[model samples]
Target chain A: MNPLWDREILMLLGGVVGLLALGTTVGLVLDRRVTSDAGRAVVVNLKARVRSWWVMTAAFAAALATGGVGSVILFGLLSFIALREFITLTPTRRADHRTLFWAFFVFVPIQYILVYREWYGLFAIFIPVYAFLFVPVRSALAGDTEDFLARTAKIQWGLMIAVYCVSHAPALLMLQIPGYDGEGAKLLLYLVIVVQLSDVLQYVFGKTLGRRRILPKVSPNKTWEGTLGGIGTATLIGALLWWATPFSPWAAAAIALLINLAGFAGGVCLSAIKRDLGVKDFGTLIEGHGGVLDRIDSLCFAAPLFFHVVRYFYT
Target chain B: MSLETLAAGALTALTRLVTGVRARWPDEAPSTSPRVYFANHSSHLDTLVIWASLPATLRARTRPVAASDYWDRPGLRRWLALRVLRALPVDRSDGCGKREALRRLIEALDQGDSLILFPEGTRGDGAAIGELRSGLYHVARERPEAALVPVFLENLSRILPKGEFLPVPLIGRVTFGAPIRLGTDETRQAFLQRARAALIDLRNR
Candidate 1:
């Protein structure tokens, strides 16, 4: 009964070893044989990933640096970048220029500042109430009536996608749950890890063994085998990491299932948005990562649900 | 040597490389001597993109004019404006002060530096071209020797916009219009109208 020798931790360790072995073997095989343009894309993707191992390692090191709050801030900056990419693709008018400016400069700062200040009440209402009112008022003052409704709605949509959805990452600080005395932030990290891992795993599994397309138009990369296997594997990892969360290993598995499922849907939906916008990636800030939005599409859906689940069950 | 300009140049080059940069000028031979380069503003990054697109020799002799209030905010901005890009500031609010600022601009032309001006005076949404302000006409009137070149900026409004903190990776196109000579019989309104027409004409072409 060693404190560190819990069944959960042991299970996660085994899973991690299994994933690394599987991913590396397939990646190496693909690297050797890729010839066509599509095949070359896969090969390049694999090689780039292998080269970025240090960057990934650095990311983990930085995540563990400031304990949990520092990790939260790191993810917060990521969400800000992702949200900025989302709205930049969407068309806006001169009438909404001032409001859009405030959205970027004022609102974004206020939302993050609230999280930094630990002002939960304000953060909760900042977007739904304050943003809703402020945007229309600013638009009305512009005095441009042509397409006023469309203009105002566009502004709101930008806030919803960029601020409201992305802010949930930092909202992890507000969770006050029993059983996990001070491990609430750790639980937040666990959820993000599980969700992002699910995404990466699905891609790996799909690329290596995919023959049947899950939904070709919405997300050509997704596959049935990847969906089922990725979620199952991620759940096993989540079940093993239950110590970080207030839930039992079984409950942790269930939560992981929900996160993976929702995250998959999010990725598909955002990809569709990109397709409709007549673009590929949201932005080129991240090399090989497409855009910030491309990276965080899953988080937009998973963060809020994860936050609420912990709040409901543990708090 | 200034950090902001150096960083801004690097960022702009990176953005252009990833997003596929294209520039089109209205006329084949752009006069290298003294010309007013006017463009539509959509993002703060607009200045860097236009500046970077210029050839080295022209870039060395070109000065981008920015607002004094914004450029004067911090040491970094000031250094970038004063030292790196060598920008001349024109006060948008104060009429008399703006007149004095025009003198400085004239001085830059006298010093053999071409000028870049954002005619909209502020950032606009990426939807369509905004109304051209009359400031360009004033500059044209004062510096008749300076050819007025209308520049149309596309996709920039959508990339960074006015208030968004991060830039969206999108291809931005800059079309530089041919030089428009101000006629002796042209009124201020007529001169501004002709300048706007020149920009619109390039955008269509």
Candidate 2:
């Protein structure tokens, strides 16, 4: 058997499958009960969301099954698509063409390559330190100073969110825990499950019991009831899965709460970018999920935080 | 499949992966009937993107109207133009050559093959639409039965601009608008302006 599919990994996969089956049943029941036109529209969207979740979960599982290199490639491709969607909306002048090319083709691949090779020293500072200075220099060489600082800043910011942050999820596989050898996949899975579960549960709770809005201007759907309920439930679930991780039950719950808060911040920040661009979604790639960026925005925030926290305490 | 067909498939797939082409038809679904797809020209990839955006059935019968001076080179370019794209190369050096090119386009339309035409005659900076040449008007007058569809290709020039050899990976949107035809008793200038306006209107849609 591949080391990636140890006993603990199998149990995690089985749990995800069981949850998906339950979601399918709820979607079917809701599809039959909704009668009004508005209610039917919401039900149809909910069903689409559930259907896409199954496909995404299968793809993720297949990637993890192939080992660390497979996961690195998958996240690398997602980062590419997400960065494309991000820059497409944020307008840049002709002078920034070559600079944008370096960001997409050069820096992105180098960053992921470092992660795959487990070069901890360079992978941590490659984007933030080197690419940060290289972007403006390349744009300055183009000799068009129309919006020099703004354009360079936009490209660098996009690289940080789309490539740098997202790569940390697969980078988790490079962690060297004392006893829990070759089981970083489980920890990555735990972070993803808790973060994504919080998102889905927030939507469910908001629709059912949400009365007050959290941020009326930024995201109208986020409610206090949804946030507290979803994060509270996901933290408890994470604590129960502490046996798979190199953490105690209380430590697991504390880390889950922190991850949930960071994920929430990620969603709101990306949402503000959308509102600034005056568009509803980033791109129409996914059926119910807006784009690759929209689907993985929460992961963008949670992954880096989770990676550092685990590296500090456990490793 | 033939070698040419295999090469075309590979080229289409590469174009889609690099550009992430998102094609939308705001007016109606794409039809298989004979039509002229006239779009704004800004980069070399404009023709390929438009050709790749077509449905496979329509792509089989659609030929692009390309400039012979550029694509008529000796080796690989000529092979791609003649075999894979099946482009009808037009000479733009002289008046006699111009008439000959129009004759060939009319012949292709009569044979029930659609043509992808760039009426600007040359590449632009992609900021604004250039003045459309008279070839689109003449083609419309000759083949009145074929529909004239306006296609707007956004962000293609940014992908592979005029002088850049390397293509930046970006999303390109192809929007097809409602078809128009030359009006009865309309002069050449009036009909050309109307056709240009139709193509411009699709930019926002």
Candidate 3:
């Protein structure tokens, strides 16, 4: 059976649509009820985010419907945009131009191509090993030693987070788990749904009941209540969807917990970077979610760990 | 659509894809009225990126003031400049050419077409905005009715800086500040200083 139309995958997508519909309805109610200027502002932002979520879900579903290749290309393009946003915020001198050109044009395509080919060994090591060495060498050859280490490290970090980490989501398709043969798409969807749901739940919880700040300096919006509530709910959801994955209910819950923690770390780490860069959001690409980087920061941290866990245990 | 329109559309799309060029109008939404969009010159892509960031309605009437010596070569470059971009070629060679270029720029403004002008007159090192040339002052002086809009093109130099051809795919920001106009008794030097300051202001923001 085609994984695209598999019962579990369709059921998962239906759940997402239902969740979005509920969100839209709730947003409409809030918009109508919230009369104060500050409350109205929050409602407006909520509506924009919900609108973007609908578009994002449709795009994600379309990509999944096309099978592995579509997801690969879609993630590839997302990586490209995320990397562009990452580098745009990082200060790179004219000396690093060639290295950046190589990063964007050569290394990005080659990495995605390796993923498409399902050559996991190379896909896993290409950016971390080869591109890692190449970036500094190319920058050194450019002869601008000023901030050389910092510059090279930044470019490498950008590629790692924006390309490498994000690529792991699609690389999930390459995992050859026993009995999960054509269902790699479901695992990919599972990872995304859990990670993003944690984020959304955190935001919802934080807005309604959050009192104490988790990391106020790094990310003011995060709170302990929100984090715990979000992780607990999303993990329960993930566990309930164990039929979509190779893992058992308990195993799925454990993995969901791990993914949620990693995603929270990723969000905080990226928010710290933004604070250091002295900007609110990375870029204004997404309507209310900030840039592609902003939307996928959690995925960047969650994907690699989730992929490796599934690969190691299930495969 | 004509081949010119098709090429223009492709170029704009390609520019957006490659650079993810984002436009931010801080003061007012983009209007269709005649205006002079002046920006810091850095990479060769600056003009196209700014032109592409404008709304299609404004883009159709907006012509970039490009150097003929560079873009007037007989081939693809010329075709892209004249046919696709519909650039207003400015001769930067001699005094007579300078006068003719100013006349042509004013003529384009008189015809009610918006213009994208790089007032530095040449590409900078991308680190800082170079001193403003008098051409922007002169053009604004002649066409007082047209808005003198200061635009700041950021990170384009890093994407495709001076002397490099292969462009790295980095997001480029095009910021359009509140429009300024030449005061009735403002001196050319003062107006030029103010214009340069306006671009610097956008950069800092």
Candidate 4:
């Protein structure tokens, strides 16, 4: 059986709740102090973001408490909603209908089920091998060849990223690291906590000191000042939280650095796609986050890389 | 809620979840005074989606007009149409003529029940709204007081296309436009064209 309880996990969760409370307090104070139209707008958005953080933190803490099953179900649901948002924007025609149905109902659920069953061998290749082959063959049977290759490719890509890649985070629950044993919960929490904090820190630093844009053509909000500030701050935090994991403080920082870089790459790529599609947000499900996809954009990119890295050296 | 009510509630929730349905009505609030919501026919999911998306207060009073040949057939199809949707099944090929079908609709409106209708009379390829069938025109004439709400359904065609049971999970939206009443001086062609235009206009917004 997995050891789900640890003092470090509790303290970490408490630290998050406390920081969110502090941010909310600061936002409320700034609400009265701010002047000018731009300042007022920024204050209002900051308050909304802080409010969303409180609710999101509470939900995440509850899921973490229930151990692996809770985390698996939570991430599984994220993949489903993320995939839904991905397909919603793509230009799918009439001929792709049945094939898409299979993707959502059959493929998405099956990939998650593989993670649940801990069939790592099959889980690794289900989307890339099985789904990749199945999507095109089934679509061809419909006999509509106009944009046939493009249509099948879009569906396959959606599964690969949304379903397959995202699943690896929860699939962290399946990692059998020698002495680390069933402590996959800590590993997942570390990845999520480090990645999310990096995003928030990047925004904060960017607002205060960022002047140079990293990629203005893709996402103007991302700046070099923000990226460097976020990476440095988050890596330090990851190093400090090393007691919960099997890694040394140095190893934790190294992995955190890798996660942040991967997260940045994910954010840039997803931002480009959203711009291409001409939409600001994926859905209105999350208040400040825009959509589930918007919130998990970083996770989608970083999860596979982090999982493989941990599985390689530790397992 | 009773067992039947529970089932209906579950089905409604499930339908909304499967289709990320975003419904936006015009700023002017929809009139609760027994109105006819006539939308375009695309896939089998059309009626269920429109019906599911309605406010619960209006939903109880509304009955979707479904084809008897398709909906009233035996097995799960009939159960869903009769039990879940509580549809008003109109005989598409009435041996006694179209008046009987028209009479039943008017009677439902007379009894203070709102209705969900498809003016196209049949499913289309979801390209342009097909030429408005005369059934809607006649209904507007009979119940001139009932608001003829033009509902534009977008993206459902790709979600469940014609003749496919399995549905893709795509974001679908239902826009309910402002209602217009039939003018006494307006001819059938003019009224139908105006209604068709109303529905098409709701598409972009």
The number of the candidate with the highest DockQ is: 3
- Provide the TM-score of the second chain in candidate 2: 0.98
TM-score of every candidate: 0.68, 0.97, 0.96, 0.93
Clashing pairs in 1: none
| CAPRI-style quality class for the chain A–B interface of candidate 2 | medium
User: What would the C-alpha RMSD of candidate 4 be, to one decimal place?
Assistant: 2.4
Docking class of predicted structure 1: incorrect
Task: Identify the superior model by TM-score, candidate 2 or candidate 3.
Answer: 2
Q: TM-score of predicted model 3?
A: 0.96
The lDDT of model 4 is 0.86
Q: Give DockQ per model, in order.
A: 0.11, 0.76, 0.90, 0.76
Question: Candidate 1 lDDT, tens digit per residue, A1-315?
Answer: 001324443454455456556666767888778779988887787766544443553574355444555655566666566656665666666566677667766877788778767687898889889998999999789888888887777668767766777778667756666654544455555766798788877877787677898889878888898887888888898787877677888898899888888888789888898888888888765556677678778878888788778777778
Considering DockQ, which of the candidate structures 1 and 2 is the better prediction for this target?
2
Considering TM-score, which of the candidate structures 1 and 4 is the better prediction for this target? 4
Candidate 2 stretches with Cα past 4 Å from truth are none
Candidates ranked by DockQ? 3, 4, 2, 1
Model 4 — TM-score against the truth?
Answer: 0.93
- In model 3, which regions exceed 4 Å deviation? A1-3
Whichever of 1 and 2 has more lDDT, that candidate is 2
User: Which portions of model 4 miss their true places by more than 4 Å?
Assistant: A1-3, A31-44, B1-4, B74-84, B94-96
Candidate 1 DockQ score?
A: 0.11
lDDT of 4 by residue, A1-315 (tens): 254778777788878888898899989899889998999998888998898888888787777788777877788888888888998888877877878878888888888788878998999998999999999988898888999877888888888888998999989989998887777887888888999999999999999999999899899899999989998999899889988888889999898899888999889988998998898887888877788888888888899999999889888
lDDT of 2 by residue, A1-315 (tens): 123888888898899899999989998998889999999988888888889999999999998998888888999999999999999889898888899999999999999999999999999999999999999999999999998888999999999999999999999999999998888888888889989998988888888889899998988889999988988888888888898899999999999999999999999999999999998888888888889898888899999999999999999
